[model samples]
Target: MPFLLNLLLATAAQAPADYTEPDHWLCYPGREDICTEDLSATVIEADGETSVVDFPTARDPEVDCFYVYPTVSGDPSPMSDLEADETEEGVTRTQFAPFRTVCRTFAPVYRQVSIQGLRQLFAGSNKGINPAMAYGDVAAAFAYYLENENDGRPFVLVGHSQGTNILTSLIAREIDGKPVQERMLSAMLIGFNVAVDESGDRGSFKNLAPCKDERETGCVISYVSFKSDAPPPQDARFGRPAEEGTEVLCTNPGDLGGSGPAALDAILPAAAYGTSGRPPAPWVKGQEIKTPFVKVPGLISGSCMKEDGASFLLISVDADPDDPRTDDIGGEVQVAGTILRSWGLHLHDVGLAQGDLIGLVESQAAAYRAKD
Candidate 1:
């Protein structure tokens, strides 16, 4: 381990005990945990019709998904404790739970920067925000998984926002071009920017390339989501190309390699799309959302777009005026009564194309099994 990581781990207070301990894990094999919850969705069509789509029967897969969630910690301290709270549990249901359909889920609770820490960072004072604290926990958890649980099975690494940032470093440090890379089927690094250099879009890592199609293994699938009408502002943090002439990677989940607009099989939460946490707006006129999840067919479409040094997933709501379905989805990050457009749909990076991602993972797992 790096000296700083070692120091952080040695200095941490109750952030982690042992990876073998079940409490440290949100989702593990053969455990009655969050990943094993019911994932039934209420499907709503373009013409205001509704139906229920239940998840397929559980089956053993040849691959696994080792996921690290974004920063959803509600701890008051700079670094969150290991205990999983409501926000963490809720986000896991939305982001990581659905992937259980394709691969076994393994989500580790880490000592991440809390909402308070993020607020401080945004306020120009990273007082207690320790990036090492988060990175150390994630790196340690990954090492434990590879040594204990992986067992030579092909695995997919999934992360978003803070998790993505830490995983980017982890890949470069541990997996890139290493023997472990062979076991890596693909990586879904969402809600963050990944820069690719002029050396054939390989700046982030030497050997790992972006996914061209579902058949490609040992590749990357990454993008930041932005509404088509509201692209990232010039001062936005995400979707901007690297300063040294490298492009920010943007891979459409619906159409990984293919270009034009592709329909997003969005399976978003039925509760609330925004920060207010209110009940979901009416899907049609008076229909109630009884299910925890909602699937809107042809309601959202995404495409890769590049303009003025910004490359991002352009999300377009294809709601027809004549159709009784709702015309929009809420994903913007709000702060102090103002919408943070620069963040752009940061909250829904996985949600926007969650269904498509699961399908892609299934295909990639099949390919990996074939190759093996």
Candidate 2:
């Protein structure tokens, strides 16, 4: 039985060649000239296939942006990569330096609210989140862009789950009080509990109010979703009521609202590799299948995608805590903020829902008209 287990492990070990380079545009810290292969591939043969795909339409040149995505626990490659480069003599060994990872695996979850405890979520080295660590790379990529690219153009910030947790603190630290607020578009924080506390400010839009009018700027467009009307647990402030009169804002760029379920049914291509050697399995009775990238939501009011502009777009993609995906993902809010109460989907695939993801970005981006 031990030998069988070892064999299974061997089969599960992913080949380095099998790992696709993460896309630069999608990377958090900006790699302005960097590019990766098309992530939309459908099949992988043992024999190689090399096909240069078409260039995607360029993203808005006027917009400056930043993003931060945190990786869950037990995954090490996102923080460190061992690579060999050739020099004059032969192969040279090089190691990348460590980046910040907050909230170690054993960190405590709170029963009540406090800012100090929340800030701990962004400190330390081995912030423990297991099964996968995709968000850290996302956050790092965005941080890089904010610091390097973006020549002071207004920007947006979006995150889900751990990504949201990391960015929430980032807003408090980096962009919240700085002069950068003038160029800011909006911050759409999705899954996490983002309250203003008793101390309020003109910039802090955490008071459950919607961005109702077109002229409204610098407000947060945040929400937490639930299947039933019942409020989610204490950790999340998103799923609560929309302060009356305010609509549950949306922007469906895919133009699918009247089209119905068929429009939402694009089949997402399977990612070639996960933390484990095997790619994620097909959507079974209990598994969450990745939705394909077709048309996503555009910037429009009362749609899944929000069209109006703000300085940042913060998102919190909710997941199931009891599920194995949340096991390595340590934080008090990780367990308390799960929106997927009944679905048994992998947390990793939740971020890739095409209609939801693209719609969210495009809708936010579309809101800002170019300043003369």
Which numbered prediction scores highest in lDDT against the true structure?
A: 1
Evaluate residue 332 in candidate 1 and report its C-alpha lDDT on the 0 to 100 scale. 77
lDDT of 2: 0.31
Backbone clashes, candidate 2:
56
Off by over 4 Å in 2: 1-35, 41-60, 76-147, 196-210, 213-217, 228-367
lDDT of 2 by residue, 1-372 (tens): 011112223332222221133332322233322121232322211122222222242343444334332222221232222221121001000000000011000011111111222233335322321112232333344454556555666665654434455555556656666776655666555444344322222222332233433333444544433322222333233332223323233222223232121222122233321232223333222334232211112111111321221111122222333322211111112233443332112232223233343343344445655333
TM-score for predicted model 2 compared with the true structure: 0.43
TM-score of each: 0.93, 0.43
Clashing pairs in 1: none
**Local distance difference test values of all predictions, in order:** 0.82, 0.31
The parts of candidate 1 lying over 4 Å away from their true place are 1-17, 198-200, 273-280
Which lDDT value does model 2 have at 166? Answer: 51
What tens-digit string does per-residue lDDT give for candidate 1 at 1-372? Answer: 022233344444444447877899898888788898888999987777888987653588778998889878878897788899888888888898988878888999888888787777667765666777677788888889888888999999999888888788789889998999999989999988877874436868889999989888999999999898899899776888655778888889899888899999998888664363323357666788889888988889999988777889999998688877776577777765577888888887898999998998888978887885
Model 2: lowest-lDDT 10 consecutive positions: 91-100
RMSD value for candidate 1? 3.4
C-alpha RMSD for every candidate = 3.4, 15.6
